[model samples]
Target: MSSTRSDVSVLIPFSKRNKDQEEALRQCPSVQMSDLIFSDIEEKETLLDYVQRVKKLVTEENINIILPTCDLSTMVHAAIARDFPHIPGPTVESCYLAFHKAYSRQYLDPAADLVPYAVVDLDSPTMLQDAERALEKVGFPAFVKPAAAQSTFGVAKVKNYQDMNRALQNLRTMRDEHPGFKSSPSAPFFKDYFKQYLDVEKYPLALRDVVIVEPYMDAEALYTVDGCVVDNEIVRWAITDEHRFDHGDAKFGQDLIAPTSNVRRLTEAALGCL
Candidate 1:
């Protein structure tokens, strides 16, 4: 807010093995960014540790905002926002709400004109059957993604039984390997002898407990409305053209113009209806 603090510091997870990290480093302004990564050589620098470290750095550096763009970072960002008041961020809870398809849908009227969704319980023995039911309810070639996911990392559009089965299996496997999936103390994976060989769950139960089956919307032209909430009001808003060409030719068309006043109003109303 001041001339001395005019520069905004953005903290993002970085890794040498990641091409995105390399690209980000190359493109980012030298004085306006900080990268944090966990390494075996860095004491107490686990993924969770990296999150806390970044938050601390944000405070010390007087960062204006924190934007978490990935699943891991978003989870950490939400946790810090929900638990710690010291962390500097805008509407972490709102972002957290957006992270889950099920919760996001809760705030909306079910009968509203929007995409359809079905909830598949994770602990059910007839899990596949439930998924199939959801498919039947939503119609074929439906979008399937972890209800708690951010990106289209595990998303798929299945048209038939075989593809559906394969997708279900893949999602189940993903849940198994999730770092946040907790094993029972009595479970074999938790036993002292086998613990070392176990893989941590990648996401927490809040994310992995349910699956969202939806009729994918046509977003050939997509745009993201970025805003900052201050004093419980949307103080500053900007429109960015969403572009994602890598994740299965899913390009966010920048040619699509930002929503005009009437369109913006409709979009906000639609978002409210989830």
Candidate 2:
């Protein structure tokens, strides 16, 4: 609430890549910095544990604001925003709806023209039968991915039933190794392994339990809009044209270019629908 940066104390969760982020914030000179241990949602921690930890940290440090820089942190922060109203981010409901691909697809179904034809809740007992029907409807070259994951962790492209089965097998393997997905809460964390499974019943509202299958649109370029909504107003920021590697299936961004007028207008219109 203070106009001067000297009065502002920021609490950023410690991440592996926080060095660059910390350096960036330190450039402001007057902003007080503090670190909160970053907790992965899909790890050993329960919803209660995560909330208690963050609540304790904010209360003890008297944090003025929270800026979540990753997907896991954003979800946790949004869920506990009522405890710290000074934090600037989306509401818990909005974050849940947006973070879960299946939920977002269903929510935006009325505006169906904007979304790709997709099937939801692929982790059910009738998954094979449902997938066969969905594939018939949506056609081949479809994408199979976890409903709530980051960095394309469990994402795969399936051209046929064989590819779909293989992708599903890989996902199952990931789930089996997941700490949260284990039968017991006492399971040890595998530091070298990355898990992408979410316990649906335990954290139903905050986490996604299923996978989504959607028709993949071949686009000339991929664009992303980065912005914030303040006081119910959508603020437009930079739109970047994402460049991808052509060599393999590793779908990582190679470069970014500022959007043109046409791309900007389209991105704004898409944001308006949300």
Candidate 3:
């Protein structure tokens, strides 16, 4: 039987100022209003520390469940769930694979995939050779981005070598500024990466060790699933279409609909595969 009095913790990675977040919190009957707003800056250790603190709080405050309410929070929660069997949610490795564009595509498991992609090490000179091959494979009008990034922050749509060079230069600068970009566990292996493709002195590459090159997807429509899981089984769920502003930031759509038949089938398959 469910406990009469319950304590729940909801972690939102970005910020509480987001309107969709505010609305989501407003609607949650189980979550306390005060237990909100956890932020993660560029610091990696902060995340490790935050999870440890949350684990302690769960015991002291009796946090029955931890809800990952945003893109970043999902990662944080997933990691915590790995070590603490009591912390219920997606595992860190699962969330990491899904969040990464390069890895996410692998899970799609399509014979002739909608998106064409390649993974590279932006720090290696051989990356140019690798990129040339990838370009030939994906063709022109490709999208280049950090392997593990969110939104359209470092994303570039390039049509030629000249455009690709300029875009790569800009991405290298962003990489220097964001440490998490370079420090991923998978960064060291890519033979051709940021080094071959960028000017490190000017860009001052920070550490985005891996990069993903892909054909630009014609994403006219996008959707997301917000769900809760107990024992790796999804329970409560809300499916929402992603509506973007001029800046391309996504939130709860004004028009809400259940997942598309295709998306539902695909998501179920993906989950089962997980």
Candidate 4:
């Protein structure tokens, strides 16, 4: 969890979240990492049980103001914020929408001009039919991944049926290496909280460990808007505009200051350092 310590941003890395990816992540020039305790829900442990378990540590260690830093931690952030109302964070429904691509596509609907896509359950009896329908709607050279993923850990670009199978194999392999992903059996609390807002009978695929098949977005430039919220006000920070791979790695990733469109500078904002 990322927090603010006396106005200096501090990040506490949890072992369960990073696990096998820890070393690869530390190689990034910008990350500030520390050796922290591992956090996870044991078998038969309820969400409240897990939350209370972590809460004890939080209070004992004087942890305050935990904000999520990525897609995987959004639900965890919501749970923590729910326990401590004084600590601000996104709501369970909002976090669910952001964390799951299939639901996000459903929620966005006709409002957004998104490409056609399908949500396929890999373990479902109708898995083949689902994939067929997905590819039919979305078309070739599609991008695929587990409905929920952190970073691009399980994502792949596929051009045909064989490629899709290969992508799922890679995804399953990653899940084995890195546990706690929503793609697998999620924590009880994470699923329980979602039940409040979603109708399981109507959208069974919403919370299931499914795969989302959609057309690959090959953009010349990809951008990310990073910011913080305080008292309902959004404090816009740096806007990172990154180019595609150079030697299999991002060629040029630069941050533009303050706002969208009318970016006046080339350097990163203070938050970028965090």
Highest lDDT: which candidate? Answer: 4
Q: lDDT by residue for model 4 over 33-53, one digit each (tens)?
A: 343344655655544455657
lDDT of 1 at 272: 26
Which residue pairs in candidate 1 collide?
A: 178-201, 178-202, 179-200, 179-201, 179-202, 180-201
How high is each candidate's TM-score? 0.56, 0.71, 0.63, 0.64
- How accurate locally, in lDDT, is each candidate? 0.50, 0.55, 0.54, 0.57
Clash numbers, per candidate: 6, 0, 17, 0
Residue 176 CA displacement from its true place in model 1, Å: 3.6
What tens-digit string does per-residue lDDT give for candidate 3 at 1-274? Answer: 2222234444444344566545644443433344544444444444444555666655565544455545556665665566567656675556655656665776686876476678766777887777777788888878777776554456667778776677666666665665444223223322122243224454332234566787765566767666655455664455666543333322213344665433333222222212
Candidate 2 lDDT, 50-121, residue by residue in tens:
556777877777765565654555555664565567655456666656766776877885845764555544
Evaluated with TM-score, which candidate comes out highest?
2
Ranking by TM-score: 2, 4, 3, 1
In model 1, the Cα lDDT at residue 27 comes to: 44
Candidate 1: which stretches are off by over 4 Å? 1-49, 52-75, 78-87, 90-92, 109-111, 175-207, 218-220, 235-274
- Candidate 1 residue-wise lDDT, 147-257, digit = tens: 654435566777776777787777667656653332111112122211221122422334235677887555765666755444456633446554344345333222334
Candidate 3 has its poorest 10 consecutive residues by lDDT at 265-274
At residue 168, candidate 2 shows an lDDT of: 71
Better of 3 and 4 by lDDT: 4
Please report, as a residue range, the 10-residue window in candidate 2 with the lowest summed lDDT.
Answer: 185-194
User: Ten consecutive residues with minimal summed lDDT in candidate 4?
Assistant: 262-271
Residue 111, candidate 3: alpha-carbon lDDT: 75
